[model samples]
Target: MATFNKFFSSVFLAVLYASSYGNAAPWPTNAKHGTHRVRTLGKGVQVEAFHPPSSYKTYGAGVDLASSFTSSGIEDKTVSYISSELQVDSAKVTFKSGYTQNGQSFAYAKQVHNGIPVSNAVANVAFKDNKVIAFGHSFVDTSKIAPSTPSVDVNAVIPKTEEVLEGKKNEIEPTLEYHALADGSVALAHVFQVQNDEAGTWYKAFVDAHTGDLISVTDYVADASYKVLPVNKELITDGLELVTDPQNTASSPSGWHSDGKSNTTDTSGNNVVAYKGSVSSTTKQSADNLVFDYTYDTTKAPDVANNVNAARTNAFYLVNSYHDTLYQYGFTEASFNFQNDNFGKGGAGNDRIRISVQDASGTDNADFATPPDGQSGQCRMFIWTATNPKRDGVLENDIPLHEVTHGLTNRMTGGGTGECLQSLEAGGMGEGWSDIVADWFSHSDSADVTDFIMGQYVTNDPAGIRSHPYSTSASTNPLRYSDIAKLDEVHNIGEVRTVHPEMVLFKSLTFFFLPNPL
Candidate 1:
């Protein structure tokens, strides 16, 4: 059976001794258009952002509000690092703390009805070694203001504030850190002092310092509801069967390619035929009203003559693309789960995948199909004659590419690190990358990338579209993530969308970070 591994647990924040980051890593040598800089800050913190110098203001107006809200509730001198698009002019972006109170609003409320100008908090952008770092106070210093002043020119404070912040670059020890995840995202840890009574509780929060998107936060005290369920082979087999039953006329009209094979009648005299080279008798287990099994064969061509090789080739292509193009390398093998229309039917509590294997001799040889099987023998790409062949046509290679790429990407980054969406984005980016790979596989040269809608290879039978629904097709399904309006759309609607996840990921990669991935 395939294995499911867990990485980081869902918890708010992690506390540890603050360590300075080592010298900044070299920038992408291949990409000439991007610049990389590095710097060290303080005893425990390190800050790294990518982009041209002076291109600080990309965060939306919401940045001002979020910063204000984040600062208003806390008393610590908040130091914020903002990210921005690379190459774009930096002077346009302005980081603000909060609105200024009107002149003497408290002492001369009637005299100064219109509030005073609020000082805009600014950050110092700098480059050290070769990576970029943005460091400075996210708020203005109230001490600089004289009490007798009728009203303070919020504008007047901007210059000195920038100078003080800029000077801190030389005073504080540099944190040698780069964002653990990527550029365009901010890394935050609550300021905690051991000897000082003023230090508040230490916590971690990251924002797309550029887009102002709350990428992730680690509090250690926040409630978490996610669980990492083990990979159940039986559930997978059952789920596959639910979506593709050739004999069952009521099954959806999805399609796939298969060698002629059959699942012989079961003990109940019901035909539970297993595909010839696809599954072995021993791996087949009766569970949850469905026959679950593991199937592997070494001889199947990526595209069988009768069944298109697009999906198979696409899967391989995805694996390769992730490694070669995306700089991700992981996972050793990939498997495709083909099943009938009733795949995910059992009570939600009992779903699992059944795994089975068979040899290439067209025999029910489990031993021959195992590791010792036929000098790296052909594994089951089961040609279940009973499967709805129609659905086979719907099998876009991107689905297999996406699934398999999950394995590879997982290995490269240790599966998941901080957030589930990070893991999910690893998967989403894998899917998008796979989709791109599948399109590229068809081209004669590097220029050949297909524009077909994603998930074109999987069945879209709204009722049973789990295995291969592209982000687009899944958009219409009730169980899928479709709405683009909600922030936490997946959790809010109990569904996840294919497009937006990829979009957020793409936006983070393309616009948020600097030193483009050339």
Candidate 2:
């Protein structure tokens, strides 16, 4: 961080001089064009976006709005140290929370301007060896921040915003915050999340507090409904049901069916593309008006192949569902999430997931291929021949989700590079995380899936494929860390990790953190 600090101090001083010379030097930053590209917004506030290939460590550095980390470095500092480095009063920066990932520690501080917080501002500094490794911040130059004292009635902003947005439900009540402008100024803004589930509309609205006028709306619904076996209802037992626009608005504003168009008839979309695999031609399952209502056949062997479209539809549905669900937990475009169009958010684009249903590559098992960022992820679902009438792996919701979770753990662990989980133990932990993700997504909040069995539908096994079902009770699942003594392979190694309730729920907390994963 010394290098980044010196770099920052120089820019800070330059901006200090710029303001002294009667110019508005608001967005002071430490970014170079080649290393870290600077983009000027319409408001003239410059933003420094770091491009990877370098780490934010001693020589390698990177930082962003959500999180910060160094590529190669030691340990990390305090709030006072952070305050001094950021050139801000310690009293003004209020830390919301802190957590650690990999070997480095991280803290999230909300910038406060004139007593009120900056709704979209953050001060990011990650340090090691008492030297700042790499840091990023949107902490307002308090001197340039617009005052927070509201001119309009604070209470009146809520109803006006809801009316302007035509929101049926106010998920987050209107709150005051100092909003930064592109022109090196700020606005007293009212921020809130509004929902209209019936109309499939949801977004976070930023309103000008002074005039009670809607300023901006960030879509929180990238959701799309699908008719397929849901998480809890696997094939052979549960029937298909309609999942009304399940994609999240924030993660996918255009929703799942859209790949630049309003709706797609086939099983290809911005988030995932599902089709038959291993054969000469990849046959896609098309729907009428986006209603992918394919019929399933329970007959034996070759006859089961007749209903391959159903499997394709199901695979597409499950993969997209997993993609959107994980996005809410921080697997975003910048974090190397699979998506056709990132809408220029960050990371690589055109790497949407590919799902091969009834794959000819293998049988009785499924797998996922996770390459580096910018490369598309591939998930192949095989046919299970154990039963007299073989089952299509794609028909089972958990099967596709389980495989897709492999991509999730792989891309997220190593900075979206997809090469981090290579060691024996790391590989084993990867498998464990996959199981936990699938297990976590397989049930609802009210359901008791502690003794969860994985791939039961595809494998046609009552006991499930894992060594033991995940359970809280020792008598039921019994496997523990002590069992690691007998396990060398990754799958069994992962089995020992997933049963812990604390670790399982720990994934849920990631929703609060901005994951760099890179």
Candidate 3:
């Protein structure tokens, strides 16, 4: 919602993404200094975000707080709502600023304990229909008493902090603030933001009020950057070119190459370990400069498999790109997404996707094998023999995009058992989800749903593999649910089930495209 305010900004959104997103920590300094942030993304309209403080519980759409408290306006009402939720007085909740859009209202407020402000504690609220529709809270405990006056003064701790920070060229005077501890306890801390000459090292260090120990430190350095292939309408159509780093910080806080355990200077990263082979054989693209610039040679024989290195690079790029894209849509670790080192967010860990490009296993089609959450999902992209020179399914962006969605739908359903798609109907729906994923990814425009085709580039067929392109018109796509009774094949049944959902999806989201940020 570019033009709208924070809460229920534009349209089709009001979706909540809160809790369990890890924050950056000290490297040999493992301290829990995580600050939760919740954001809601509507289509292309506007936005809202929710990240509750490190509390025991978080509430969403269903947990209505309308009957709790009342105020003259949304501003005071938001403050009162948070106060009631936290069992604190309304005076402790102080409103900073907010705005209203399309009749929905939102307000941002900070938590205060006995008048001294609490660090990293805030409430972002949305109001509608005379009730608190939804809100994001990251508040500290006011019930537990902290020191009103600091035993360790701000001035006395600078030299000690300076020793830790090496040499501080510029510094913000330390302020006394209440810091929340991992044990659900509160400690009065002196907060300092200092900058140094060492490669522009800046630190937000917290010192304990009683003993003056370093509570937590966040290095305000730049995130890692990379140049890789991005999602275009179709990579085969647009050709290859490395775009600047497209990492989503909310999902990948440590960057793509690092999974908090170790770092990779190549295609192997936290989300995926990509290579070219029948199995785990090595053909990884190593770029110390973080640029994966493998070129596809169309003039060569067996067009796709001849340049095996480029196939691996292309597959690697698609997996990571689609991983971040799905994360924004709530395929989170808590929701059973594939990722190595889930950063203690939730679900299984060390299950990063393993992709094999130009696989010697088979040809003419690609596939993904998804086990449970903790196990790595295997994606095998085969060469297509439809034309004189075969096409690699890896280079066809939608093909890999389709396969990755198979992992998503398989792991997400039936409590992430990965065996839920055993039934013919269930298996058909799984295939349907894959086609829909690619269809949406390749949707030419907002109104480009009726003519969407999957595997067009790989198959070298204008009509694609399925019986029909996903279309609303009965003439273009005549498949109905009753046809599932006649069809025993999963992909065939999938063609039947896909058309109707695409109609529904096209209706819901007025605009659809993944590459651009929402």
lDDT-wise, the better of 1 and 2 is 2
Q: Is candidate 1 or candidate 3 better by TM-score?
A: 3
Ranking by TM-score: 2, 3, 1
Residue-wise C-alpha lDDT for candidate 2, range 413-459, written one tens digit per residue? 43454533443344555577667666656656523445678778767
Worst 10 residues of 2 by lDDT: 509-518
Tens-digit lDDT track for model 1 on 1-518?
01101111000000000000011212223431122212222243333322211112222212222333233211111212232322222232333211111110000000000122111122332222222222221222233332222233323333332232232111222111112223332232111111110111112233322332222322111000001011111111122212112222222122111111323222111111223223332222223433322221213432243223222222122222322232211111111111222223211111011111111322211110111000111122212222333233113333333333332222222111111112221223333333333333333332332223443322343323233332323344233332312322112221232333332132112111111111
Model 2, TM vs. native: 0.55
TM-score of each: 0.25, 0.55, 0.55
lDDT of 2: 0.57
Q: Candidate 1 versus the native: TM-score? A: 0.25
- What candidate 3 gets wrong by more than 4 Å, as runs, is 1-229, 278-287, 302-306, 448-450, 501-504, 510-518
Question: lDDT (CA) for every model shown?
Answer: 0.22, 0.57, 0.60
Query: What does the lDDT read for residue 499 in candidate 3?
Result: 73
Candidate 3 on 8-109: residue-level lDDT in tens? Answer: 122112111111112211111221212311111112221111122332222334355556454457667777777877788888888754544456555556
Model 2: residues with Cα > 4 Å off, grouped in runs = 1-225, 260-263, 278-287, 300-306, 504-518
